[model samples]
Target: MVSIGEFGSKIKENISRVIVGKEKTIERVLAVLISGGHVLINDVPGVGKTMLARSLAISLGLEFNRLQCTPDLLPGDVTGISILNLKTNEFNFRKGPIFTQILLVDEINRTTPRTQSALLEAMAERQVTVDGRSFQMEKPFFVIATQNPVEFEGTFPLPEAQLDRFSISLTMGYPDEQSERKLLKGISDEHPITSLKPVSGQDELDSVLKQVKEVEIEDSVLQYIISIVNETRSHRDIQLGVSPRGSIALMETARALAGIRGRRFVIPDDVKETACDILSHRIIIKPEARLMRRTNRDVINEIVESLPIPINNEKT
Candidate 1:
């Protein structure tokens, strides 16, 4: 069996064939997948958010599907609908794109609130209900949703409930000049991702996911996580704080990060590294904070920075 770090590296190297730079973002995505969670890629258009999802799906050898969300998109369009079959004189159900293992919801913010709510159940419960019947999703179901900036035209901001369902939110900033030049030079009629192939198999994926649950997290580190979460609730600048789910996500993500780095135990750095990504979207900043130009990321970072690291040399 391959180590988690080796598995992570294999996928990262394979994805790099198409996705240039952004190594940290790729790693975080892998960690989230191992933790059995979804990702929200929030960025301006043309930053390769969709491409990143495609490359990841291809590299993981998972069943892939893409939904181009629009204002006309409906709940049934995402969760599927029951149809009357005249031949059988009964209702038959047709599965939608959400049935796939790796579902890339492109421009998710463009969809209506009713349509967006359709995904909440699936994301949180890994199942969909149609006409009083519930269908369980396939194993390894993961959602990689991409959205344009909420400030962009014709986009609806995802409600906090929807945002909390996502384990982590990431940004694919414009690649550096060197990386861009490399990308430009490498461009061809066929995209680089088309030639990319899976490097890891289902067995490895399952093993790593199982092992992530076993990754040791010390008491001190657990307290550290709680401290950060508790602070969020009382912070004067914030109106709403992260829920218990956020702390759970932080702990699970830290475990995955430890496994990805080839460590059997989690450290403070893992939590610190993933806190902003996992907790930023889970929080709601006050209007006063926004007026002061404090973004969610900024508030999360501030909280993380203020916390004292537990004294431990077990796995630094």
Candidate 2:
């Protein structure tokens, strides 16, 4: 039997066959998968953002469903609507695309804000409410939404509320020449993604998620996370800070990172590595701050630098 670590590596290798020069992005995708958390892939077109999501779904052995967001999309479209069953003379709920274990929402920003907000409930709760009824989703559910960063022609940017629901947001930057060369050499007239197979089953995924939960963090690290959130809230250039749920995402992602490193403990590095992806999307800078040309990366760096690094047991 292959160890889980080996299995994880195989999954990464399989994905890289299709998406070149993105080892870190692959690891982030894996971390979010094992963490059982949703993700937002924000990048320019033709950068393989959607391909990454599809590759991940195939590699992880999860059921994949994709929706191309458009202005015509309705809330009932993503989350199934209730209807009257003529024979039974009663209303019955039918599941939508979001019902699957792995859902890829491609070009999510292409849809209207009203249609986009419809996902807020599903992404955050992992369930849908229809006709005044709530339904719980099965285990191993996750959403991987993609957006084109360079195009604003007809796109509606995700609101801060919906953005906070994602555990991480990332861009798939251009591949290096060597990586692109390798990618060009791998073609056999068919997409590599079709040949890809799952590295682990949903059961294995659930087990790994359990392991992620087992990873522990010290109280000092908890304080560090809080300090960062507070700083963002009080920053003169910022209009909003990460919500409590965002703090939870940071803590959860830190544990998942530690687990990926084969450890049952978390350190400050795990938190720092995840802070930007986790917090940047959740904040909104003031107009003056934006005019000052300050970026989300800058704010994240400043907050991270201001926090005192915690010493481990050796310091005590």
Q: Pick by TM-score: which candidate is best?
A: 1
- What is the C-alpha local distance difference test score of each model? 0.91, 0.83
Flag regions of model 1 displaced more than 4 Å: none
User: Which TM-score value belongs to model 1?
Assistant: 0.97
* Candidate 1 backbone collisions, by pair: none
Top candidate on lDDT is 1
lDDT tens digits, residue span 142-222, model 1: 999988875568888899899999999999899999999999999999989878898877888999889899999999999
Give the range of the ten consecutive residues with the poorest summed lDDT in model 2.
1-10
Clashing pairs in 2: none
lDDT of 2 by residue, 1-316 (tens): 4333555687788888889899888888888877767899988788887788888888877788998898789988988989999999999999888888878899899999888887888777777888899988767788889988778898888887878788999888888999888888987889787787776676777667666776778998898889898899999888877789889988988877776766678898889988998889888888898899998878888889878888787322
In angstroms, the error of model 2 at 104 is: 0.6
Deviation of model 1 at 306, angstroms: 1.1
